[model samples]
Target: MAVHSLLLGVVQGATEFLPVSSSGHLALAQWLLGFDEAPLPFDLVLHMATMGATVLYFWRDIVDLVLEWLGGFVSARGRWSEGWRYGWAVAAGTVVTAFPALGLKPLVERMIHLPWAVGLALVLTASLLFAAGRLPRRGGQVVLSSGFFVGLAQGLAVIPGLSRSGATIVTGLATGLKSEEAFRFSFLLSVPAICGATFLELRSVGSWGDFTAALPSGWLVGAMAAFATGYFSLVLLRRVVTLGRWRGFSLYCLLLGLGTLALSVVRG
Candidate 1:
C-alpha cells in the first residue's frame, strides 16, 4: 500500500502540470496496478500537497499581486496597477472556467473510470497541443478576452484525459499571449480552481472520525513525494514552454493516447 501510494503520488505530481492528464494517468495506473480506488481523504491529501507546491513556487508572484492591489487602493493614483489588472484577469478567467466545469462535473465523474474515454480525450488533448505549437508566437498581456477563452479551455479539460494546465496554457498561447505570461496566468488561474475542488471534496466527506480512522502512514509519504516532484515538474515545464518544446510533449501525448487506446481494446 505504501508503495502504491508513493507511485500514485509521483504520477499525480509528475503529470499534473504536464500536457498529459494526471487524472487519466491515475485512473489507468490504478487499473493496471490492480489497486482499488483511493479514498476521498487520500486523494484530497495528494491534491493539497500539489497545491502547496504551487503556492510555494509562485509565492513571489502572489505576494506581488496582493501588494500591488493594495498599493493601487492606498495610493493617490486611482488607476489599477499592472499586477492588479493581471489579477483581475485571472479572477475573470476562473469565473468563466466555473461555468462549463459546473455543467460537466457529472459527465466527467461518470467517465473517470472509463479507460477508453480517457484514451480518446488524450488524443484530443494531443491535437490541441499540436495545434497550439504550430501557432505563431505573439506578445501580449492576458486580457479578459484571452482569459475567457482560456477559461473555457480549462473548463473543458475537466474531462478525465484533458489536462487543465495544458488546455489553458495552450489556449493562452493561441490567443497571442507570450509563452511565459501564458504559463504564469495558467497556473495562477489554477490556484482558485484547485482550492474549490479541495473544498468540494472535503465538504462531501461524511465523517471526519471515520475518515481519519483508517489514515495510513503512506499517505503522508505519498503527499511529500507529490510536493517534491510537483515543484520540480513546474520548473521543468516552465523551461519547456519557454524553450518552445511543447511539440515534444504533444508527440508524447499522441503516442501515449494511441497506446492506451490499443491496450484498452486488447483488454476488452
Candidate 2:
C-alpha cells in the first residue's frame, strides 16, 4: 500500500501541472496497477499537498492580493490598485468556474470510471491545446472577459481527462493574454478550485472518525512526495509555457488518448 501510494503520488504530482490530465493518469494508473479505490481522505491529502506547492510557488502574488483586498475596505486609493484589480479578476474567474463545475459534478464523477469517455475527453483537451499553440500572439491584459472564458475552460476540465492547467492556460493564451500572465492567472484560479474540492471531499467524509480511519500512516509519505514533485512540475510547466512548447504536449495527449480508447475497446 505504501508503494502504491508513493507511485500514485508521483504520478499525480508529475501530471498535475503538465498539459496531460493528472486525474486521467491517476485513474489509468490505478486501473493498470490493480490498486483499490483510494480513500477519500487520502485523496484530499494528496490534493492539498499539491495545492500547497502552488501556494508556495505563488506566495507573493497571493499575499499582495490579500493585502490589497483588505486595504480596499480601508481606503479609496486601494480600491484602484493593481492588486485590487487582480483580486477581483480572480474572484470573477472563480465565480464563473463554479457554475459549470457544480452543474457537471455528477456527470464528471460518472465519467471518471469510464476509460473510453476519459480518452475522448483527452482528445478534446489535445485539440484545445493544439489550437492554443496556433493562435496569433497578440498579447493582452487579463480582463474580466478573458478571465471568464478561462474559468469556463477550467470548469469544463472537471472531467477526468480534461487537464485543468492546460485548459485554463490555453484559453488564456488564445484569448490574447501573454504567456506569463496566462500561467499566473491559471494557477491563481486553481487555488480556489483546489480548496473547494478539498472542502467538498471533507464534507463527504461525514465525520472525523471516518476521515481518520481512512487515512493510513503511509499517506504522509505520499503527501510529501506530491508536494516536492508538484513544486518542480510547476517550475517546469512555467518554462514550457514561456518557451511556447505546449503544442508538444498536445501530440503526446493525442496519442495517449487514442491508445487508451483502443485499449478500452479491446478489453470490452
Candidate 3:
C-alpha cells in the first residue's frame, strides 16, 4: 500500500475503536485531501482490522460467550442450564438490533452525502453523551428494552460523525447501567454489529480486487496500529467512565461538529 493509504488505514483503525467518530473524521479527511472516492473498501478493511483487534483483546469473553450460546442452541428448554439462558439473551439482542440497521443502509448512504446532515448527527451524538453523563448510574443489567433502545441508537449512528461506541454507551447509561457495565456491554455489542458489516462487504471479493490486492501490507500495519491504540483507548475509557468524565468527550464532539459545519458553509 502507498503511504497515504497506509496513513488512512492507521487513522481509521485507531479512531474506529474509540468513542470518536471514525467515519466522520475519515469523510472530512477525504474531502480535505481532495480524494475522489471516499474509500468505502478501505473503510471496510479498517473495520475488519478493528474487528480482529477486538477479538484479540476480548478473546476470553468471546470464547465463553460462544460456548454458552452453542450449548443453549443445542439443548431443549435451553433454560435448563445457567449458561444457556444468558446465551439466548445475547443472541436475541444481537439479532433484534441488526435487522433495523440492515433495513436502513440505503437510507443512511443517501443522507451521508449531505455534509450538513452529518454535522447535525455529530451534534446529536454530543447531546446524547452530555445527557448520559449527568444521569446517576445503575448497576448494569442487560435487559431487552435496553438492548432495543441501544440498537436503535446504533442504527442512528450510520450517519457520519456519530460514534458507534458513543451512541451505544450513552444509551446504555441512559438505561441506568453503571458506567463500567455500560462500557462493557457497548463493547460487546460491537462484536456482532461490526463483524456482520465487515462480512457483507468482504463477501463480494470480486468488486474489491484493487482494494484487496493492496490489503496485505495495509492489513499488517493497520491491524497492529488498531490493536495498540484500541487496547489503550479501551483501558482509558474505562477509567474515565468510572470517573464520570464523559462530558469532556461531548465538548470535543461539539467542537468538531461546529467546525465541520463552518467549513462546509465556507466552502459552499
Worst 10 residues of 3 by lDDT: 81-90
lDDT of 1 by residue, 144-251 (tens): 787688888988988988988889888889889999999998988889989988898888876889677655658988899999999999999999888777788888
Cα error, residue 108 of model 1, in Å, equals 1.0
Worst 10 residues of 2 by lDDT: 28-37
Local distance difference test scores for all models: 0.85, 0.87, 0.71
Using TM-score, rank the candidates from best to worst.
Answer: 2, 1, 3
Residue 161 accuracy (lDDT) in model 2? 89
Q: Model 3, which residues run further than 4 Å from truth? A: 35-41, 71-86, 207-211, 214-219
Q: Judge candidate 3 against the unseen true structure and give its global Cα lDDT, from 0 to 1.
A: 0.71
In order of appearance, the predictions have TM-scores of 0.94, 0.95, 0.86
Superposed by TM-score, candidate 3 places the C-alpha of residue 104 at a distance from the truth, in angstroms, of 2.7
Model 3, residue 13: C-alpha shift (Å): 2.5
**Candidate 2 C-alpha lDDT tens digits along 1-268:** 7887887688778888888999888777766667677788988988999999999999998998889878988999998876776777788888989999999989988887898988998898899888877877767877778768988988888889899999999888888899999999999989988898789779889889899898876888889889999999999999988888867889999998998899999999
Give the best candidate by TM-score. 2
Worst 10 residues of 1 by lDDT: 76-85
Is 1 or 2 the stronger prediction by TM-score? Answer: 2
